[model samples]
Target: MATPEDTPSQSDSTLSGCIRPFLTKSGLTVRCQSRVRSQCPSCAELYRGDWAAIARSGVFDGPVQNFRFYLLTLTAPSFGRVHRVPKAEGAKVSRCGCGARHSVTDANLRGVPLDEASYDYAGLVAWNRDSGLLWDRTRRRLRDYWPSVEFFVVREWQDRGALHLHTLVRIARAEAPRPALLGESARTANAFSKVDGAFVSWGEQGDCQAFRADGDGAKAIWYLSKALNYVLKDAVRASGGGARSWGHLARLSTAARMVRCSPGCVPRDCPSHTHTRYGARGHVVSASRRTKNRTGWSFTGMTRKRQRELRSEWVTAQAARAESAPAEWAVGVLEARAGRAGRELRSRVDVLP
Candidate 1:
């Protein structure tokens, strides 16, 4: 039954005074007390507690499980021309922009997609190639726009083979900002702009469109997960050589190489590698590697359900650890001080104990 009047505003000295002792006892140290950000020491303590709990759980006692595997595809715009070898005998050909008749030997005669018209397509491919950089840039821009908002960027290619980015962001209750305002700031930051505006608009195309999934954790994850599927479908189609209009082979080849490379190599020592440690703990867990034909790579180990369960357990453990800490000691001290002050006020007002 805490009302607005009963709650302390973020700027209030009384709230800081009440919270400081508990924070200190909890081993939370803030470099900039004015900023009110989650201190690293606090995060480390929570992470360690979660890790200890998970290690005790024995959920992953069995052999590793292989989770779902997906194929991603995308139709990329043709960037360059090549010698056109006619499959049919005596096939009629047209002259190229270079004034050479389209033929096997005449590389200049090869027709390529118009550069300006295909600028967006090119940009999209480049975006896919450097989606990690784009995500880092976007997150940094968002931080500048709103100092309290924090996020982690995860980049993946969709089945259709288009590059997709998934960002897991956390905004403190006191630090939440308007999504619309952040979106405006994002656009202004040149997140999807180009030297020429036409291609810029093309590359910026995504089902998620604007950055509207702010503050709402479930909504944001859903949007990102859906977008991941969309790009994966496109990537798969492009990889399968089905999108001939976009000159599928080259695009497919590039995507195939990327898939094989596994762009962000999740090291075995990285906390993300441990499926159970996600969100609550920090333990480096390497992605399961599946080698195909001595060249290709795919992830293996841990079903999605198990991963979810493990993550839930870890989070619960962290909350328990936070709650079990000596918060009551700080509370007891504050209550004693408040009780003495109340007694003094009552004595002055001629009240009996």
Candidate 2:
């Protein structure tokens, strides 16, 4: 009864279970700040791997209710049909070109073309490339609704490989000039930005909903974080390393052949619990070596403030680094990184309008 959105993309042959598993008996903990670490080589959050960044760099800080937040998702148009979880009971059941039922476990085939000969791979890639521009424009649109606001966006792929956006919009107490206006909000996020009386097209499908900072606040943040982790494999893959997580990776056999196991038996050499079902939705949005962001807006009021705070903290930590230099060296590095990231974000964005 669950749709593709509800069903996670995973196969029993590939389900790595539990929170990052411990493969070895050592039980040792190591640093995971390395951007190249993770199971999917293509994860982008490799560099921005701060969990606290979710709250500190979130739409707003503190004990909730200080600001207004909304959870918005923008989806790309369907290029062609592949397989989909039914929207409801007895929905039209379309078969792939291969003429198969396409069970829920056929996750790898979710966004793939039934007949690769007819799929628009090139168009899909171009849309993915300009995705950042669309997001930048979305930010500009939000400004018209609220005098001052902030947004946190994460880009992921639909089961069918179309890139979509999951955004968290923040408006401070001083920013919301009027009461909640769902009409304006929908026009801003779901519809395109305006230019010279013309509606600039964003894509095909978009959805937006407003949620207060009460119970919905944490839920929004968690959803954003989860989305980021999903597309991370592509980022790390382009960085030239196998995706590393908190668990120790174990290998059972090189072959994909099924291995029978005894009841209540767990193999010590089994690979770490890295499940791809909930993994990346698209391929590489942009390589890790690029200086700017090809995805979300990482620079806003909250982000800039958080960057300054992090610079101070990094400066304090320099005492533990090279003895010849003070915290200033590390501070310089972080500042440069932040600056480059902003430029990279603008690179794709400024190219659009």
Candidate 3:
């Protein structure tokens, strides 16, 4: 819905390529752009690795996992409502903060304030910037309250353009705090900060829910994993620029990391790929190699269900399908060893129909 008025445009694309489309086993044709070192015949895409890793993390396991699991959502307070689709085509007309009812198709008005004059852009941007600090402090405080607890956090942006966090926190069953107590701790963590000579807080206290992890893993993990799907929304692709990735998860404590893989691809004796642990003022106390962003800006045009399936087999399919024609092999005995393992890897990672 953006008009090409304020920003200058009109240059022909020097990058004269289009996203190549390919057919998948599920009867879906995926559109993906080729990357330089990509092995996937169809080009590597988003979330394939992230979901697998998170699921493999065992936080969602009902009894086997040692830590208690909880789902928490931290949000930016609303300036005003814009427009949204009703439950039915003409279910009900809800008034915006400005008192006028918005039409269903007025979806373009989602993030922008109903009355722009009153919206606080500076406050919103500041909160977005300092959110990493806020989260770090909150994690430390949670640990202080119960020394042995741990957490895994993920973040997503809302259609309203506010950065809301989706966290999978882990604590021992006996140490699990009451919902109200945890909520109070979260709000308490958001006490005032002086920014640009005016005081501002995170504004919203946020939401929390407990994950029972008792039912189908595919069903139970859906709520936690689907939060990542927000990156797939059109609003995110166009406007979310650099914020598409997790900013706070960058320097997350190594002790509190979300384990992404069990029997992970990295071989034993391989260089470690853990995160860099940063101290209070943003100094690195422990070091690990920096990694690239996980979520990307693209229109996969896949449904949420299809997206979920990709989490399991997407990377495996890509690896199996990759053209590794110039195969590395050792002399006689080692070559046999390599071939056996390669076959096993391929078999384990084969795409599910």
lDDT measured at residue 292 in model 1 versus the true structure, 0 to 100:
42
lDDT of 1 by residue, 162-216 (tens): 4444333333345555544544444333334232222321133222222223344
Backbone N/Cα/C clashes per model = 38, 25, 1
Q: Candidate 3 — which residues are off by over 4 angstroms? A: 1-48, 60-65, 78-93, 191-200, 215-219, 231-353
lDDT of 1 at 186: 45
Q: For this target, which candidate reaches the highest lDDT against the unseen true structure?
A: 3
**Judged by TM-score relative to the true structure, which candidate is superior, 1 or 3?**
3
Q: Predicted candidate 1: what Cα RMSD to the true structure?
A: 24.6
TM-score of 3: 0.51
Instruction: Give the number of the best model, judged by TM-score.
Output: 3
lDDT of prediction 2:
0.44
lDDT (Cα atoms) of all candidates against the true structure: 0.35, 0.44, 0.45
Angstrom error at residue 59, model 2: 4.4
| Tens digit per residue, CA lDDT, model 3, 1-353 | 11222111211111112245567699755544332113332232333333334433434333434445566667766544434434336757777665667664554554555555555444454455455567767777877896655444455555544465666565667778876677667656753443233333454657766665554456457765655444233212243212212222221222213322123523233232321111112211111111253111111222334554654365444333332321321133355558999999889886745
Assess the local accuracy of residue 241 in candidate 2 as a C-alpha lDDT between 0 and 100: 14
Pick by lDDT: 1 or 3, better one: 3
Task: Please give the range of 10 consecutive residues that has the lowest summed lDDT in model 2.
Answer: 245-254
- How are the candidates ranked when ordered by lDDT, highest leading? 3, 2, 1
